[model samples]
Target: MTATAPDQDIALAGILRAQHGVISWRQARRRLTGSAVNHRVVSGRWQRVHLGVYLAYPGQVTRIQRWWIASLAVGNGRPALLAGLTALRLHGLRLPEAAEPVHLLLPAHRTDRDPPPGVVVHRTRRLSRADARLDMSPPCTTAARSMVDAAQWAFDDTTAVSIVAATFQQRLVVLDQVRTVLGTSRRLRRRPVIESAVADAGGGSESAYEIEFLRLCRLAGLPRPSRQSVRRDRSGRRRYRDVYFDPWRVQVEIDGSQHMETRGWYADMRSGNEIAISGVRLLRFPGWAVRHRPGEVIADVRAALEAAGWHGPSLSAGSGSATASHDGRVPHRTRPILPG
Candidate 1:
């Protein structure tokens, strides 16, 4: 049942339009001769972007087009899904840095010895249909799997934490989805790191600000505060505190741009007044302060904790201390809280 020339032309046009003006040599050959493909490239109507991928139109390529080209080139005749940081970016997660060498996941039975430039091929035996959806135009992993994979492939622990935090903050993926993907993944590298980061994100520190604040508290030697602690105002209305040092009666609030709203601002003011009347000292830090001026914020928090009668060991300026690392990494320690 071969289609007529008019039908083939219509199908090819549809594919070109849907794939952002990109097509593979093998696909083009299905509708066109080898000479026709070469003639289009030679005439500047198509540009060879990868070994077997060509742009149908000679115009600026978009990020998605680049991803599509990479996938098609590596795919060859097997399954190759965009993954890791690349997939996360596709799902709209703001990464600290752009992911170079686009990550592509291929099945174990398949291999790409000559991946196109700026593409990194990852071989996995467990790339099941459940883990990826081919219906997507660019064809990538599920949001959950992409987030977890990005976290595992992060450059450092901090970056990994940030990736998970951003994914949750953006609401691109849910915690349960991440957990399910991890449970199903067979060879997930750095499983514990990914789990810890995702746990922290789900445990109320979902934003970059909250994650940075958590790290700051750890590095500053402050007692771990209850995250998103529940409380009731005088009218019996429920409210949640970002971080609460129960023993010291200190409340730390991380304010993002959303708090700039008139209603939100008023609510915060009311909450602060109530908290102050209840003898709870509130320390508020803008998201920028938490991320950019952490040292100053930590110092202020330390002073507030001390003023609130916290008499635990103070942060010392030496090796293994918060000040020494300066990277916001707190050394693990076990110290019982003593009576002030």
Candidate 2:
């Protein structure tokens, strides 16, 4: 049956909308002729985003648009999955910092070719259909695969572990899934570090903040504190603290921006009041302290623990520690915080 031009336009619009305003030349050719495609490009109605991909709109290109173009540029015979930090970001996993290079994973059979500008193509022989998600817009790698890939591609161990921790804390992907993906990836760098970070997440460390706090404790020679410890308030309501030194009757609360929200703030206040009434010394540290200023965080925590009847050995906050350096740059330890 012959279709009217208007019907074809509508069909094209649907395709464009489905692919986030980007389409492949082959897909466009199914409904548009070479001359018609060239005419649209010349008229500025469509812009060539990649060698064989076009932007259906003239407006500013978007992240999703670039992703679609990268995926489609691989051609039909092979699949190119948006991968690494890019895929993890799309899956709602926030990174410690901005990532770049618009990573794409192409099947090994696709060959190692130069990717379009601003795009980095990775050829992987291990990528299977199960590892890729075809349902997502711009079809990217699955969350587990993307996370593993992101961690492997990360420049540092902290960034890599943070990716694992953030994804697990957000419940975007489970530990078993990450393990499965890691198991399949035999030669991933920093494998032990990734495994340890995943184990920390499994142990109830909700975020990278909690993991850093634990590391600080270990490096400072402080007694290991129970994590996500449950304590009952005066009203019998149970509350969980991020880390608790039961012997010293001390509880450490790791506060992030989420705690600043009205509801979170009030809830924290209530928890703090209850813990205070229960005669427990509470120490609160901003999440940033644990991440960026670990040396200071350890010093403060050490003082707080000592003040809370912890007669343990004095901690040596020296340089080359696992947590952080105690160089002159770090602020000196302040007086121990008293019970509130």
Candidate 3:
């Protein structure tokens, strides 16, 4: 039996609500006459976002609305779930470059070319039901699958690793989930690099800076330091150190850009004072210094470790014993520092 007009109105409203006010021409044609759809667009009540996708509102499209438009525009009678960095953002994994050019995943059989501008479509044979969260509005890949996709599609190795690390740090997904996804995605790009990053993240390297610091230690031949080690401050509050040489009583803090903020700066100063009062030698380096000035970071860390009773091999700057590669990578070192 044909549905009544009120029922069609209710269905259309529900779709617009769930899709963030975006709809496809194919969907609109089912609920209303072609003249009705065209009248809304002509009267400025709706805007065409793509060839067949329309926004119910006339104002600027939000980021999330853009996601909906991307999915609906390219769906083309098939699944088109958001994946890669775009899905990672929806999973609450914040990053500097997590905006624009919505990434989408389509079935391997999809041969449709010419996706709308500012949309990237990736075809995969392994987009199983387990990999996608169909229940979500503007459906996206699962967090673990999204992380894998984001890492696989990242512009560079560092970015790939950073995405994985941030996912773990944000508690968006578990190590086992990521490993399970990787286990099934056998032919993924940068698989080894993603695995190494996952290992580091699982070992408690909560940020990319900490991961880089661990690499520097291995490059300089320094004894591995525990990462994100927990200890009580003077007032008996639990404090986590970025890197700690437990035996030598030396601690190194890697300050990210957030440390420049007033509150973060004060909090860090307090943490430093606590470390000093606890009789641990404290050394601090900004995130940039770790990436751009690894040699200096290595020299200072080596000196502090030596002074605190580490008799490791000298990695002095003058002797040229240990140095980072020109590309700012530590060669032949992929071991992760376990937490204490």
Candidate 4:
């Protein structure tokens, strides 16, 4: 049957709209003649992004478009879901802006001899229907699975730990979901580190700095402090202390880069004054000190605890609390600061 020019244009627009302005060569061939497709490319109406993928529009490619391009370029009639850090970003995890390649996951048996530029291909035998969010546009691994894969695929142990912690801290996925994913994948790389990060995250260490502080406390054999514990100020407003030694009436606040700003500095000073007036000792450490000058941080924290009458490491400090679970399991103290 012969179709009118308007009909063809309408069909092409529909395909582009559904796929974020990306069309595979096969898709284009179905609706366009060979010459027609070539002419569009020659005229700059369509741009070739990958081997057989085309960007139907002319401007710079958006993130969503990049997802579609990666999916179509390597999918080839099989699953090519976004995984790892790429999927985590789509699920609302805040990450630094960098030229990171799109990470795509395919079945273990599928192989692409020539992967597209700016795209990283990963093949896995463990993928299942349950691991994918099929309803999402340019289908991706579920948040939990994506986080697990991200941690496994990270460049180093530190980066891997940060990925897991940030995922939980940002509330991209709940602890249960991550645990479930981890249970299903037994052979994942960096499993131990990932589990440790999860435990810390569940214990209310909401940032990398807080996680490091917890490790330092353990290294120095200090009593574990309850994290993100709630307390009322003079005005009766509830505040979440970063780390609190409840038995000794001491608090430790880890200040990230944000605390260096004018507003943050003023707010922190006000909070410190309030803590002092309440007769509880307060210790503050910049984020860099926790990472770089661990010895100094440990000394100051120990001094504060000793002055507050902490005789030695005592289980009573946080024995049954979120911070100190005897079985190495974290209590349900983590609450999402941001909506997932």
Give the winner by TM-score: 3
Give lDDT tens digits, candidate 1, residues 307-330.
999875645555344752366434
Off by over 4 Å in 1: 77-79, 96-99, 212-240, 245-249, 254-279, 284-329, 333-340
- Look at candidate 4 and give me any clashing residue pairs: none
Superposed on all Cα atoms, model 3 deviates from the true structure by an RMSD in Å of 3.4
Q: What TM-score should be assigned to candidate 1?
A: 0.75
Clashing pairs in 1: none
Q: What is the full ranking by TM-score, best candidate first?
A: 3, 4, 2, 1
Error of 1 at 6 (Å): 1.0
Error of 4 at 158 (Å): 2.5
Q: Per-residue lDDT of 287-337 in model 3, one digit per residue for the tens? A: 989878887788798889888878986546755345666765455544443
**Per-residue accuracy of model 4 over 1-340 as CA lDDT, tens digit each:** 8888899889989888878888888888878998999999999999988777889889999989888888887786233799999999888889888888889998999877556788899988899899999877788999999988998899986788788888988888887787778778879886766776777786788887888778667646689899999989988999999999999999999998999999999999999999999998999999888776777787788889899888765434545332323433223333223212
Task: In angstroms, give how far residue 151 of model 3 lies from its true place.
Answer: 1.8
lDDT of 1 at 109: 89
Q: What TM-scores do the predictions have?
A: 0.75, 0.76, 0.88, 0.85
Ranking by lDDT: 3, 4, 1, 2
Candidate 2 minimal-lDDT segment of 10 residues: 331-340
